[model samples]
Target: MTGAATGLGLGIAERFVADGCVEVHGLDITPTPDRVVPGLQHRTVDVGDAQEVDDCVEAILTAAGRIDILVCNAAIMQDRHEVLQTPDELVERVLRVNFGGVFNLCRAVGRAMKDAGSGRVVTVSSQVAETPWPGMAVYAASKAAVTTFTRAFALEMAPYGVYVNTILPGTMDTNQMRDSFAGLGRMTGADPESLIAAKRTSMPLGRMGTPQDAANLASWLASDQASFSIGGVFDLTGGELWSRS
Candidate 1:
């Protein structure tokens, strides 16, 4: 799991550990927490760095003997600029981290899975890939790119019996979401709390989703139950995608 130090990644990792995964290795830019369920190992590295990603995968393969399931959940979202006001560097950085991270990991681990003739890759995407929001154009575009690339990757890997799917997560009370949208609130004159409250109220569930919500979906996708489901995008959007006018 990438970005396993916090939010959705942490939640997903926790769920895997709970499901009796004997060895769960987490990779992230940040250090792992001091305590977690036993057998959870942390390998701190930048996912955007291809060399680092390659080394990390090699280490895991040497240690674990085989790769079974790979989850690419590292991503970043910046909300300060629209297309015109956006800097070239900013767009590149976001794409490099958000999309490139997935690209690097998938190519590295994916090769192993393809060689082994079986594996499951579940990538974390966002609802914004389909639903547009003001000021998040670049982030949304990157996810859109990911979603499309995910489908193509799935097709290529399918011949080897490896299943690849993208999980499109909607708004959730993640720390990253709060921070990004908080700034958005200031600029738009919408109170951050009210905006969040309104979002929750609008959801069919009448509540914002939790990290565990996404984790549960991921766990299901990782299991044998989802074996035949490839080249698919599973929505974990708390009904946000289906919300009506």
Candidate 2:
């Protein structure tokens, strides 16, 4: 699991450990994660760095012998900035983590799964990839790119028995979401919290999704039950996507 330190990554890792995954390895950029489950082994890994990702995968294989399931959830969302105001460096950084991380890990782990002739890869993408948020063009594009690439990767690995699928989660109530939407306060002339609350209440479900909700679906996708499904983009947006403009 990538981004296993916090937010959805942490939540999913916890769920996997609690579900009795033998020797779950959680990878994060942070040296110390917010929470450490007893069974999940936390490792400091910058998923954006291809060399680092490769080394970490090798190490995990050495220790665990085989990685049956790979989860790609590491991503970054920046403060909303219109394309005219965005810096080139910011675009590159976001693409590096949001897209490149998935590419690198999938290539590395997918190779292993192909050789083993059986494995599951579940990726966390965003609904914004399809909806295209106004000021988050790069983030949305990165997500779109990954979702497409993961689908292609899935096809290539299918004959080898490696199933790959993506999760398109809607407005998740996380610290990252709050921070990224802070700029919405400016556009709405309301405080960020108020804007977020209003958005949540306007959702068809009357609430935003949570990390635990994502974990539940991701867990299901990682199981043998989902083996028949590959290259699928599962939506967990709490009915928000259809309701949104």
Candidate 3:
């Protein structure tokens, strides 16, 4: 699992461990800590670098003998800015980590799974990919690319018994979410608390999602229970995407 050092990725990694996965390997650009959840091995890796991702996957295969499941969840949401004001470098960086990272890991691990004749890939996208928001152009675009890529790749890999699916999370209460909102609040001169409260009120379910909400669906997709499922885009948005005020 990429980005497993924190936020939604960490929650998913913890869930896998709890589900009795033999080995749960987590990759993040962040430094590997001395201690993580039991049964999870943390590694420092930049998924945006294709060579690094390939090397890491190869190492996992060499050590674990096989990789049964893969979760491509590494991503970044830098400060929000309108398209015209967004710098070229910021766009490139976001695309590299959010989209390129997914491509690299999926291609490398998908090949291995194809050869093994079976695997499960769960990618975390965002509801914003489909429901656009002002000042989130780059982040939303990157996730949109991931959503489409996963759908196409699923078709190509289905014959090999590999299932690929994406989870679209909406307003999850993760560190990244809070940080992004806080940053946006700073830019707009709005109190971060007010922004968060406004978001909560907008949700049809009356609350933002939890990381565990995403983890539950991801866990099912990664398990045999979802064997017949393929190329699915599961929404864990609490109906916020379709809410009518």
Each prediction's whole-model lDDT (CA): 0.87, 0.88, 0.91
lDDT of 3 by residue, 1-245 (tens): 99988888888999999999999999999996334688888999999999999999999999888999999998998788999899999999999999999999999999999999999999989988998888889999999999999999999999999999999988999888898898789789999989999998989889999868878998999999997888899988999866631
lDDT for predicted candidate 3 compared with the true structure = 0.91
What lDDT tens digits, residue by residue, belong to model 1 across residues 1-245? 99888888888888999999878999999876534656678889899999999999999999888888899998987866777888898898999999999999999999999889988899988898998778889999899988999999999999998899999988888888888778788678889988787777888888777889988888988889985799799988878887741
> Model 3 compared with the native: what TM-score?
0.96
Residue ranges of candidate 1 with Cα displaced over 4 Å: none
Candidate with the greatest lDDT versus the true structure:
3
lDDT of 1 at 36: 69
Descending-TM-score candidate ranking = 2, 3, 1
Q: How does each model score on TM-score?
A: 0.96, 0.97, 0.96
- Candidate 2 lDDT over 1-245, as tens digits, reads 99988888888999998888997888888888887689889988889999999999999998878889999999998667899999999899999999999999998998888889999999888998989878889999999998898899989989998889999988888877887668777655678887887888888888888889989998999998885888899988988888782
Q: Is candidate 1 or candidate 2 better by TM-score?
A: 2
